[model samples]
Every structure is written in structure tokens, then in C-alpha cells.
Target: MQETLRRMQKKRAAGEGGFTLVELLVVVVIIGVLVAIAVPMYLNYRKGAANKSAESDVRAAVSAVEQFYTENGNKYPDDVVTPGAVGVKVTFKLGAATDGQQVATLSPGNTLVYKQLTTGTYRICGMNEDGKVVYKYESAVGGSVKKTSDANLGDCIGAAAPA
Candidate 1:
């Protein structure tokens, strides 16, 4: 019985050597393929998320600017737009507006910008993840807020927004 048991154990050990190099290499290749596929997907998702975050932030900034206009005698606030008690500051600069021009263009700064086109009309721009200013919000006196552009851009002009 002992001799038979020894023979059985020797047979099992011979048949059950560790995985071959080919099997290990296959496993490594599979892992590499999976990583290659997942990395680009994850990066694209991150970029989309960043764009969405910028959009939401731009909307919030526009709302704050509207409130600022209301609080400050129907004129848009200059230099900065601070929202709520927490005081998130959106910087703004007054763009040059020639006579007979109806659209007031607001160029975005490091933060955001608010441009008063007329007595009540306003335009707001915000910075994208790339640090470029894109037109985000537009409103006329007694009108609703309109989203102007969605592309990340250098200036809010031409294809970016309505002239």
C-alpha cells in the first residue's frame, strides 16, 4: 500500500508542474490588451466630465451675474461677480461697444466676464478647461437666459457666437 501511494504521488507531481511560460505570456498579453482598451476610454470620459463641469459652472456664474445686475441698479457689476455668501468670484471686463451696436460681447477672463450690451441686455462668457474663453450665456432686457456656445475657443466671436 505504501509503495502504491508513493507511485501515485510521483505521478501527480509529474502531471502538475506549474504553468508553462506560454500560458503566463498569454495571460500577460490579455492584461495588456485590456489595459490598452480601457485607458483611452477612461481619458475620454474624463474630458467629457471636465466639459460638463465647465458648463454647469458657467450657468451658475450667469445666474449670479443676473442677480448682481438686479441688486446694483439694473446695471451689470464691474470687475467681479461674487455669488452668494460663500463668495465665488467670477472676474469680468467691459468690452468696447461702438454706437449702433445691439449685441454686447463679454470676453472671459481668468474667471468669467459680464458685458452689458444695452440698458438691460447682457452677455456672459466663461473659461473652458483649456483656459480659452467661450460664450456661455446671453440675455436681453425682460428676456430669458440663452446658451450661446458649447465649443472650447479663444474668443466668443464668429462661429462661436452670433455676431
Candidate 2:
């Protein structure tokens, strides 16, 4: 028969035919355990999408500082931001929002920016590093954002004092 079909195609290419180093080390240990459970769940879903894009830029900077404090009556905007003003450069420029040991700030010469132990008055906030769902301006507050070690919330809202 053509030499017994060429010895059955060389005994089906010597029997096993391919993969075997214990099946390529069990597919490289199942792709290294699915990349170690998908890289810390893609780095906590990229830090919860940069903390919901920094709480939607803290409710668009508390509605642009309450519309610049109701069009410049109650004060607040010490000027500086004007450049294109939306979320004011990714949620108030950050470096942990300029710490005095930072958590948020700006004010001096930039006019009114606060955060670190803020007393800018109670208005916008966002909590959820585990203190559990807080938000303020875009609404959803009920108290409980106290996990403070400063993961950069700019101290979270006008903290109930600064008028």
C-alpha cells in the first residue's frame, strides 16, 4: 500500500505530535493564573476610574464655586482659573491638591482654593475608599467619609465652616 501509507505518516509524526512539557507547563500555569487575577482587577478598575473622575470633578467644582459665588457676591473666586475652566485641570490640579501636607488648596494669589482641614463650608464632597458612598454636590450624602489619611479628596468639600 505505498509502504503502508508511509508507515502511517511516520506514525502520526511520532505519536504525540506537539505540545508536551507537561502541556507547556499547563499553559504556563493557566497564563500565570490569568495574570494574577487580572492585575488586581485592573488596579481596582484604575482606582475606580480615578475615583469616578474625581467625583465628577467634585460636582464640577461645586457648580463652579456656586457660580463664582452667585456671580461674585459671596466672594470665593480669587481669580486665576479663567483659562478654560471646566474641571479646572483634572480636578483642581492635584499633587494631592497642594498639601500643607496637601489634600487640596489654591487660594493665595490664586484666590480661593481649600481642602486641607477645610472650612470652606458644607457643600460638595465625595467619599468612598471604604467609608462607603458619600458624594455631595451631585448629591448622595448622609454622613460617613471619615477614613482620613488623605487619599487626596482635597479634604472633601467646604467642610462646614468657611463662609
Candidate 3:
């Protein structure tokens, strides 16, 4: 009986059909490495997307200002759009708001600065995740638009006009 039991035990040990602890650990490590690599990539992609979105918003605002200028005798918008100001005519259409609210605010928690240098000379600038002005559109008084930054916007400057 003892000899039979030993033979059965040997058969069971030989037929053990599962992964060893080392093999499982290796697989887990590989998966962990992959996750570590993939997560940052995805996060960067998302950040890039946000930056582009903010840039697009600035583009739209530029277009609106240009259109308004063309329709109103080539004058830049005279609205105070940065919130908490008064006594200015908000005479531009910047994406769902025509009441002096900055178009940059449409980007949802993005830091965008807007300035009207002179009559028909204006700039709309937006910051990236690193708080750098990576996107900017400068509208000169002569109906010309130019891109003035290349910090973090990818492929967004392909259509930039000569400064």
C-alpha cells in the first residue's frame, strides 16, 4: 500500500500543470512595465489634445475678431473680456459668447491671456500644461494674422505666416 501511494504522489507532482511562482512574477513585472510606459503616453496625448483645443479656440476667436473688423470698418474688438470689467462694448462673437467674455475661457480651466495692443492689433495667447504660452495669434492692423509661438503646439504652426 505504501509503494502504491508513493507512485501516485510522484505522478501528481509530475503532472502539475500551472505556472511557477517565478513565471507568474515575470508576467506581472512585464505587465507593470507596460502599464508604466502606456500611462504616461496616454497622459501626454491627452495634454496635447487639450493644448490643441485651446489653440483652436484661439483661432476661432481670431477669426471672429477679423470678421467683426471687416464688417465694422477694420476696427479691433473693444470689449473687455477677462471678467470683472465694465463700460466697454462687447462687440465680438467668440464662440457662444458675444458679451465681452474672453474666448479663452471657453477652454475650461486653461490660462489664456488676451490683449489688444492698438487699434486692430490684438493677440490671443494660451498656455500649455507647463504654464507656457505655447499658442498665440497676433492680428495686425492691416488684416494680417501671424502665429508667434512654437512652444508646445505640435503641427499647429504649419500655416503660420511670416512675422
Top TM-score prediction, candidate number:
1
lDDT score of residue 103 within candidate 2: 20
- The TM-scores of all predictions, comma-separated, are 0.60, 0.37, 0.59
Give the Å shift of residue 103 in candidate 3. 6.8
Q: Worst lDDT window (10 residues) for model 3?
A: 83-92
- The residue pairs that clash in candidate 3, if any, are none
Task: Give the winner by TM-score: 1 or 3.
Answer: 1
Residue pairs with backbone atoms closer than 3 Å in model 2 (clashes): 78-111, 99-102, 103-154, 107-113, 119-162, 121-158
Q: What is the C-alpha lDDT of each candidate?
A: 0.50, 0.43, 0.54
lDDT of 3 at 18: 74
Identify the leading candidate in terms of lDDT.
3
Cα shift from native, residue 25, model 3 (Å):
0.5
Write one digit per residue (lDDT tens) for candidate 3, span 1-163.
9999898788789996577999999999999999999999999897777767556656666766666566655555663333212222223234234533323234544444455676647676554345444567766534433345565332223333212
Q: Where is the poorest 10-residue window by lDDT in model 2? A: 100-109
Rank order (by TM-score, best first): 1, 3, 2
